[model samples]
Target: MNNQTISAQLLSPFNMGDLPLKNRVVVAPVTRSTVGEKRLRFMAKYYAQRASAGLIITEAAVISHQAIGWLNSPGIYTEEQAEDWKQVVNAVHSHKTPIFLQLWHCGRASHSSFQQNGQLPVAPSAIKVNGDYIHTPLGKQAYETPKALETEEIAAIVQDFSQAAQLAKIAGFDGVEIHGANGYLIDEFLQSKTNHRTDKYGGSIENRYRFLGEIITAMTKVLSPNRIGVRLSPNGSYNDMGSSDFRETFLYVAQQLNQYGLAYLHVMDGLAFSFHELGNPITLAEFRQVFTGPIMGNCGYTQETAEAAIEKGDADLISFGRLFISNPDLVERFANGWPLNPLVDRKLWYRLGEEGYIDFPAYASSS
Candidate 1:
């Protein structure tokens, strides 16, 4: 496609709520999965490099100590962590780019090695993730059956989300996105495949949604609904997800989320992450039916497909993950018809330091 045609769809400016985006391209959150003292250092420069995106969602940041699962992933619980994040926000903001922090919890996707006193991870039920192993501080370990959260204990986790939102605001993030997808804590509660709670947090669809509902409600106290976003993966099979009632579950979720007037509803509609194949995958057009607010289509979208989806009114924005890693100047390349850099090696992805993380030169510099 010609540059004009490409710019018309993907590069077009958009007003996401009251925020003005220079373009519709977004930088999706990607976990580098690094550990140690170097974890938070280079992030500022890394994000600033890709500030051209309409919106930038940082890699998932665990909300609290209990939420810890990824070996060396960033966290939002401590004031120190929030303080460190301020540098990243300032760096991105210096380029006039809006960035959002993705709040996350690993839940049953975690191993006891990452937990306090070797305590087991917490989930809605005492079920183990059917996956073989997970990377923990001690090393790769077998997935353990998580301890079922007590009904009363649920409130603390909800508050942790709220507190994380508060810290995101303090860190100068434009907003926050709740990581409710990919079979994590909230996903465990949302899908029946993992959640078998008899309490208010499980069983019926509404009950299953209660955990996320409470989280959203709590977070809104710290930030307006318009400043928050939630992500869902109805078609995802990651972390042993995918339910037979996926359609009913997500449709009900969209319908309910429509009430909150959120910043946007991010749906991972593409099959890059692999689908559950419970039936035909639920498309962005399906979500558009229930949600009247702005919607972003994520996972495995290319310039052509993202453009087509926008033209068809199926999505307002598209978030690119792997592509953004190698092409720091992705928007510029797309605007000028420059070819994207080849995908980086997978082993280089999660390692600490500059190699694959921030060393990818922009198109101009590379030329």
Candidate 2:
């Protein structure tokens, strides 16, 4: 295609409800274990560096202390935590970038050491994932069977999500994304293999989707329905999760979410770039038909692949994860067709320092 044709086809703005994204590039939610005060300066610097993207989704911020099952993951339940995140939000906003906080709950993926009073992790079913280990202050330990959440407890958890969304807004996030993906609590209820409950939250596809629907409804009241989004991994088998009726589960969830008139649906295409057994092998285009709203495609996407996805109407937006980890100015590089800086250290991916976090050189400096 000619330059004009290519530019016309590849570069276009997307309207995510009331929010107008300058382009289709989004910085997907990524977790770095900077919690409380430590995360304030670090996360602010990190996001401000990548401010060129149309939108940035902050790492999954735990909804409550009970919901936090990982070491150093940030929480949104307290006033102090919200205050700390306000600085990060302000930093990104100063660069004129819109950011959304990804609200999360680990469910059975958490260990007792991470829980208060050494309480058991909660889930729809009291099952322990088979092959995963969790790091504790004491040391690494095998996953433990979680306590099945009682029906009453489920209501409380939903409220926690609602409260967190409110807190996120207070923290000055442009919006909030409910993390219903990656085998977390919401995903646990959505997947049959992980949820054996016969209550209102499990069994039939509709019942299994109850938790997600409730969460969306609750969050919508706190934030406008047009400002809310959800991230899902339909075929994701992460954390020992599966569904005999994957199509039914995801399709129903999408249809239900569509009724809310939410801003967008972020779908992680698990089978795009690899031969992995973890996520279902669904294409981003397939999910497009199921979800009529704006869709953000993620997972193993390159600049060319992302551009193609936008050109073909497979996705209205593209989210970059690890690539953004090393190259904060990823959108500018892509716009100028510049070479990417190599990921120098994978060890620093989850490390709690500014070495790899803030020290990556921009294209101009590297050249």
The runs of at least 3 residues in candidate 2 whose Cα sits more than 4 Å from the true structure, single-residue gaps closed, are 1-11, 36-41, 272-280
Per-prediction TM-score: 0.98, 0.94
| RMSD of each predicted structure | 1.0, 2.1
- TM-score for candidate 2: 0.94
Per-residue alpha-carbon lDDT of candidate 1 for residues 149-211, written as tens digits (9 for 90 to 100): 999999999999999999999999999999999999999999999989999998999999999
Give the range of the ten consecutive residues with the poorest summed lDDT in model 1.
33-42
Tens-place lDDT digits, model 2, residues 1-367 = 4333433433567778888778778999988776544434478888999888889999998898788776677788888889999988999999887899999999998888878899999999998887658876567899999999999889899999999999999999989999998889999999888889988898888999999999988888899988888998876666666666776778778878888888789988744423325344667777787888988888888877777888898988889888999998887677776779886465677767687788887897788
Q: Which residue pairs clash in candidate 1?
A: none
Superposed model 1: Cα runs more than 4 Å off: none
